[model samples]
Target: MLYLSQVLGLVTLALWLYCVFDVITTPDTLCRNLPKIGWVLIVLLFPLIGSIAWLVAGRPERTQAVTRPSAFPEYDRPGRFAATSPDDDEEFLRRCRERAEEQRRNAPGKPQDES
Candidate 1:
């Protein structure tokens, strides 16, 4: 009986410490029912009951896992923007290359090939 009581006491102390640390480290936004400080005080004052209360009522609810959409929409699908826009088209690239060649030829120090 004595050994059981001692074990119970140790368990209670461990729970109290865990609750205190959890309350301290948990973000203010995630804590529910009361403010972070209030939860801390509660855990400190009444170890077993307070820890249970924090676990049950004060802790944040777990968010649901994000699932993939059933119908894969065009815009939301993979590689939606892989198709080249007008600026990235082959004609646009040819025009840009021609302009660069013209500028290179017009530069004063560049010797033009007379072929």
Candidate 2:
């Protein structure tokens, strides 16, 4: 049983390493809510639990599908929304409000928005 346990331990270590590397290298969009660096740090600092955490909950939801390079045609265009602003979220909200005002002005009718 000791020999079997040793093999199992080694296999677990290999799996942990694999997860750590992938978590580190994948983009923030790929990592979703959990920052990529934070995930990598968690895995590196707490190998056993971190690996399990990744397997159970760390991976982003499939709402953002994985890009398969093999599936892309030679003339495939890059994604448009790849850039992220770590800056003020208020700016985005401000833009949304401005757009709504403009749209309302352009639209025919009274603007009775309750917001």
Candidate 3:
């Protein structure tokens, strides 16, 4: 009987400490039924009963995890632009080809016969 009482006392102490800590750590926005300070006071003062009440009435309800949509999912990628298709910028490609042909013609080492 004495041993059972000791175990129960330890359990109650653990529960009380846990509840107090929880109340203190819980965010003001998330706490229900009362403000964060109120919950902290209740848990601190009433131990087991307050802890039970906190669990039932003051604890934040579990919410579905929210997944935010990316503002620019395609363009947000690292080292990549929003425009993935080269076909969208045909003029840019045309200028690049013209520059490459002009450079080839101006090469100092190349024989004139190749032209």
User: Backbone clashes per model, in order?
Assistant: 0, 0, 0
Candidate 2 clash figure, as a count: 0
lDDT of 1 by residue, 4-54 (tens): 889999999998999899899888888899999999999999999999999
Q: Which stretches of candidate 2 lie over 4 Å from their true place?
A: 68-115
Task: State the local distance difference test value for candidate 2.
Answer: 0.77
Cα lDDT of all candidates, in order? 0.87, 0.77, 0.84
* Per-candidate TM-score against the hidden true structure: 0.54, 0.51, 0.55
* Candidate 3: clashing pairs of residues: none
Question: What ranges in model 1 sit over 4 Å off?
Answer: 64-115
Question: Per-residue lDDT for 1-115 in model 3, tens only?
Answer: 5698899889999999998888887767888889998888898889989999999999877672334569978766788755557777988789989999999988899876653
TM-score of 3: 0.55
Per-residue CA lDDT of candidate 2, range 14-100, in tens?
989888877866677777557778788888888888887876677866676777675646446666454467455778878889999
Q: Which of candidates 1 and 3 is the stronger one according to TM-score?
A: 3
Task: Please rank every candidate by lDDT, starting with the best.
Answer: 1, 3, 2
**Regarding TM-score, does 2 or 3 come out ahead?**
3
